[model samples]
Target: MSARFGRLRRVLAVLLTAVACQSPPAVRAAAPPGPAARASGVVTWAASADRMGEGTAGQGYRLVVHTSVGGSDLRVRFTNAFGDRPLTLDGVYAGLRARGAALRPGSNRPLTFGGARTVTVPAGAVAWSDPLPGRIPAGTDLVVSLHTPDAAGPATGHWMAMQTSYTGRGGHTAEESGANWTQTTGSWWYIDSVAVRPSRAARGAVVALGDSITDGWHSTTDLDRRWPDYLARRLHAAGAPVQGVADEGISGNQVLADGAGQAALHRLDRDVLSQPGVRTVFLFEGVNDIKAHTGVTAAELVDGYREIARRAHAAGVCVVAATVAPFKGWPEWDPAAEAVRQEVNRFLRGSPDFDAVTDFDRVLRSPYDPERILPFFDGGDHLHPDDKGMQAMADAVDLDSLDCAR
Candidate 1:
């Protein structure tokens, strides 16, 4: 019995020793929720993507975009979302914009993908360039130059950039001189979003998700007079923490249905939540849905809004609902649409789903006729606001409301 007990103790000792000598299995840390999970960088500027005309081979495009927040490690996102075939970009460059397609000398830097200068975005996919080692300032007219060696399918781009861009015949993207980039275009091609690493760790971004008005339809081109632009300047001047701004508005976008681009609900993940460091979504849409008269009811639109708020909340993002602006003079304005708009605005004003509300209808409505937009703010179309109106809309928003606890 003593011998058996001693053998058992020796076996147990051997087991313990073997366990101590062996390594434990590797464990992966849990991924944090939401866009910060990617943590590549924060979005400084962005434009919504839609189906544009067919892409041209050997076409070099010089896209002029405005940045909202200053940061280093600048990166650009290219989309082939609407393409049926692979889109290959052989040369891509980023630089500070001087006059008319001209890049500031020595500021033009070539961008690479996974260490290669060329990248082929798969059909229905998007790719982001490796970070460029540099810092860009807020409100910089950043230029992205790219040459597509064989891009043939339907192109993906923003039609109403509200800023002028240029196109050259061949791979002239490396040239800083504007002489090679003679042709002018009003749209931005290929690229959809630009991101940068902010100096402050807590810095976040806000995305304006809406329609043509938010797309800067009536605002002066090249001036960056859109309401969101004004808001960006305000955030910068005040030294707000949420400094980045992305305009994800399409001209004919709706809340419930697909038309101009994917409906706000469908594209919410890609355009809003997926954006890095997006703290809030300033939802100013639903005007197109009401005006289109597709038999969409107020209840349906309200449901859409509620879903948006819920999804955003689940992703740790705050939602600021904006009342739909009055448009009594626009051709689509009728008693039925006006009724829906009024009901939606009522819901937006009091809904707990949103973190805060901005009464744009109250700000833009004419005192003499509550249903009509204020003439001073009207862009003559009665639906969209003029530059002054845009400024007023931006001013009405409480900057503090945008920076909320999520």
Candidate 2:
């Protein structure tokens, strides 16, 4: 009995010694949740495959948010605030490339929605990233592979602002969704919300809303010289990460009635009020109404603008009204149209309804002749400002009103 007991003790001792001497098995943990962590020295911008800015037809595309400020226990967000149909995801994976080859040995992971592996966002909705493991540090180029589950239609992209990260500000409720009737009707529609990220010391965003001018009609492509782009560039240059800009312009949009887009009132609640981090709203419109919708008189257009300002102010947004520019030689230009344009300009120059004003007309109209666009600034249409003309329009904005840091 004593011999047996000694042998049993020896075997137990051997097993314990081996366990202590040998290396332990590696352990992995569930990723934790927290605020967006900073991935230092990173510049994150949104983009899809195939086109630098435009997504392709039929084939699915992924918009990558490059993170310069990376940190641990991190997660990501995907968007479809501009999609027309339900965006179904096939599989989501993360990857890092070295000289166009996979850098991180295991760069793929299944993405989940509402904490599950797959998600479907209805038109105008966005989905967020589940907590991903480990850390995505500075200089890490992470790509999310998104597959569209169905055949898609002709796509249009929001072209004005050069955005950094494409953020998901959650879904638009029925009340919010109902405001954009043009989107619901579906002739052609774009984004509905102002995407902004949470920044240190309380982040805020400025919303720029208007028609083609705000859409940057004649501005050179990839130059990113849109007024809002200039504004954001100025802000960022000034180290004003606290404030961002959201360009909500839709080509052919008007203040009083529907045209290429729903009337300004039809979109105000969603584009202006429901926007995330929107601290200020720059309402630059009325040219289209003056040129195309002649049924509404100058007085009516002025009052309509006043109502827009009223609505914005009621919602606590600082409103800046822009004076209409000279459109005397546009193909659609007529003496009656010019009169309405002049009358509308008169209201903007001296309107007490807005919190402040920007004289875009003063900047683009030739010094020698106030009614005619400077020969250099005309896009030959007479109505739309050329590149220089657009820049002049941007310069007309009251930088102080923007209160942007840079």
Candidate 3:
């Protein structure tokens, strides 16, 4: 027994010595690609794509976006979903926003596509940049600069960004100074989604799929006062498992028809399911369908909700449906539309197709009338909410409901 003990001690001593003498392993700057990495990556920010007039040659866009989750190995996606010809973006850079059209010094970095500096996305397709090696913090104002050398035909973008972005002529994308970016636009061009590899492998994202309210029409511009923004801050503060939020809302968007941005049903795959690491889709639309008086019955609207839930479930994603809020004071509001809204809200509350439901209608409806929006929350249009109401909507969301798995 003594001999055996001595031998074991000597072996352990030699192993320790060898380990101590060897150099430490090099730290990897970027996460390796695999099923694990793929699952861990989440969309930190997103906006739905739509046709935004014609793209001009030699035009550069310095688009500003707000991030929800911080992580490394950042990637940006550009789309040409409505273009008639291939879209070539020659110079693309990502940086931290210092001010209007200006990027933080030393924060601007060139983005590449498969090691190439330039990429041309085909019409009706999207392109993702190779991961940039760095960390971006949550709640950051990220600026994406890109130049189109020969852009023409229909340009794909989000027209109502609710945030300011800058445009320039020629190849001024690499400049960090705001001087070159003299023109201002309230839209985001080319880029639609920004993703990152989160530190926690279990961290995931929720995409808010909705209309103008979700698009933040009435919220204060450049303040990040959107309901999703408020929700993101809440998630971060609470240390929730789902730390990422992607707002896939479009102004005047509908759930059943292709008027505003190719109806929620038609663009579901591209706007929601295709997003990486999305675990839940928060559906809060359908007011337009009811108010438009296009003869869309409550049954038809309910069917659309079911289809959305079914498709999301098939892709291993959960769905949380929000009832359409009151909008009685709007010009389109009438007894017929009010009846339809009530029926649809009832369906949303009781639907088994959804994993959970949020009663935005109850929150926004006035105590005096229930069908009219609460006077305090109204943004004067009776359809949208102000910043305070936006916060209230965010607060009403039970964060746990958004943390479910497939």
lDDT per model, in order? 0.85, 0.53, 0.86
lDDT of 3: 0.86
Instruction: Give per-residue CA lDDT, model 3, range 1-406, as digits (tens).
Output: 2557534543553354234223221211111122322323899999988777788999999999999989999999888888878999988999999989988999999999989999999877788899999899999999999999999988888877878799989898889999999998878999888999987733889999998899987787788999999999998888888988999997667899876677889888888888878989999999988987899999999999999999889889999999999999898899999999999998889888999999999998899999988989998879899998999999999999997756
Considering summed lDDT, which 10 consecutive residues are worst modelled in model 1? 24-33
Rank ordering of all candidates by TM-score, starting from the highest: 1, 3, 2
Q: Please write out the lDDT profile of model 2 over residues 282-390, one tens digit for every residue.
A: 8888887877745879988888888888887876777887888787777667888888888888878787787778888878888887788887888666766767777
The TM-score measured for candidate 1 stands at 0.90
Rank candidates by lDDT, best first.
Answer: 3, 1, 2
Model 1 over residues 283-355: C-alpha lDDT tens digits?
Answer: 9999888987789999999999999999999989999999999999888899999999999988888889999
Tell me the deviation in Å of residue 332 in model 2.
1.0
Q: What residue pairs are clashing in model 3?
A: none
TM-score of 3: 0.90
**What is the TM-score of each predicted model, taking all chains together?**
0.90, 0.64, 0.90
Question: Which scores higher on lDDT, 2 or 3?
Answer: 3
lDDT against true structure, model 1:
0.85
